[model samples]
Target: MRGRDEDVISGRIVEVEAYRGLEDGASHARFGRTQRNAVMFGPPGIAYVYLVYGMHHCLNVVTEVEGHPAALLVRAIEPIAGAEWMRAARIAWLASHAGNRSAVAIARGRDRLIAAPVTQLASGPGLICAAFGIDARDNGTDLCDPNSMLRLEPAPSEEPPPEIACGPRVSIGYAAEPWLSMPWRCWMKGSPALSRPGPKAAGTGGTDSARIEGTEPQ
Candidate 1:
């Protein structure tokens, strides 16, 4: 992403969750397209940013053909560059979120953001948005456009691709049986940047559908 001043920040996406509209019970477009989810129904390679918990922003990439409404939620990313800028942005967000705009509080937040491991700087979907200053304003952006402020890029091929693992999506207690239990979430194996280190497979534990955490309606 490039800030207004041309400050660029970049990261490698490490985890994602696929959502198939209407057919997928956990998808935002399960009920068909609305004003909020219109981007998902557009052409492929568009951004579908949304706010969750009234504050945190989550980013998704639209996939499939027009009107298909398929997307991949960017669940986690590994920060690659612009550490200082990311720290400042994250600290500003943390301070604003806490409603503690005091200098001391902001300083403390900056310290924490700076001290955090680079892999964790943009680890979660929300954290990545905060660190890179992405939000609803970026929704519907053409992610395939090279000139876009927040655009997707091919990964550098100097290193081998990391092995990937698949597991059930997280915090979707309201979704029905098949969708709720589907192993649609993919992540790089052994990546410490994942929001949750160990993904729970279906039948590994109880199907207690009452434990939704850190999530709102899709």
Candidate 2:
């Protein structure tokens, strides 16, 4: 979720990528602790927001208890509310970056060879952040806090998690070796919000949920 004060942006997370420290070459914390990655070294349930390519802010969920540099990069989300703000934000971002062609395409509903729909607004990581107004300022945010401006709530469904599929992460050729091939990414079976998609390896079934690490919801 993102908001200035009263206008909150909300969505349902649908895709994510996992990074494990000391073993995952593509992870920022693979080398060692630093000021930039300190959040990842902290407790789980926090938002590890960071900018990539100087253009987008990617939101990650810290995990593996305290002092462990592990995170799940939130890849895509299905818009739940405040879609108008998301559309305006994307257009504004494009215009600011001198992306006239794309902006015009977006304006004319001609980009991606078709009109981009509201649900597709946050289909990618950068777009997700952009759509929700998430930026570097939201780094280290405690997503578990009920009082926090940004937090994760239960999905509209009361049922268990959807069928899951695992696959290799996106665009990390620079990492080399197995890190590039590790299938740490998972998503809801065939969500349209996935940044990328591929075959699936079925894994029985289980509930997928998040926690603040304090009090469980009753």
Candidate 3:
């Protein structure tokens, strides 16, 4: 693992999705800044959390200029530490929703239900939150502070396979037209891990999903 990975994993952040900005129809800032979006006025590397669906919490990182609320939605992460504890937490939640032993088994015992390795653990925002044990309590945490648990790390120095590409973000149907097409989502070019098949070219439009693509796990 590298310093950057640790920065993102250990840091605290309540998951809150951002919908671009005022210029974009999908952004929360579309209506302009108020008390709730004050953080969006700050520089990059700040948390921008909000409640959605009147129930779930989503997380985002403020990026670009002070007023331009561009943010990367932390869709997932590869688990690093506290794997078992994270798994237990998720399992407990699943168990509670389970109505029978079979359902519990299916929920708790399935391979998908198991905690993935630290490297593969938090590949998505929701997975990242679960892997690092983040919850509503972590809302409004600072990510830029080195002392803070939540921080963004530069992607690994080594180059990933030339096949990486970018595409539209996944599961964001609510984001209107252009916002949906903005190529912000990244992933391995042709790796099987990609939920959707990537283009034939080299690193172009897919989201970057590798924790440390060219380097082996330490």
Best by lDDT: 1
Q: Work out the TM-score per prediction.
A: 0.84, 0.81, 0.64
Give one digit per residue, the lDDT tens place, for model 2 in 143-177.
88877777776765876878666667788877977
Number of backbone-clashing residue pairs for each candidate, in the order shown: 0, 0, 37
Worst 10 residues of 3 by lDDT: 209-218
Every candidate's lDDT: 0.82, 0.76, 0.55
lDDT of 1: 0.82
The digit string of per-residue lDDT tens for model 3 on 104-189 reads 46754645667444344444565555445555655566777765665555554784534435555677677777777665566543
Error of 2 at 118 (Å): 1.6
Alpha-carbon deviation at 7 in model 3, angstroms: 13
Residue runs of model 2 more than 4 Å from their true location after superposition: 3-6, 99-114, 200-218
Collision pairs in model 1:
none
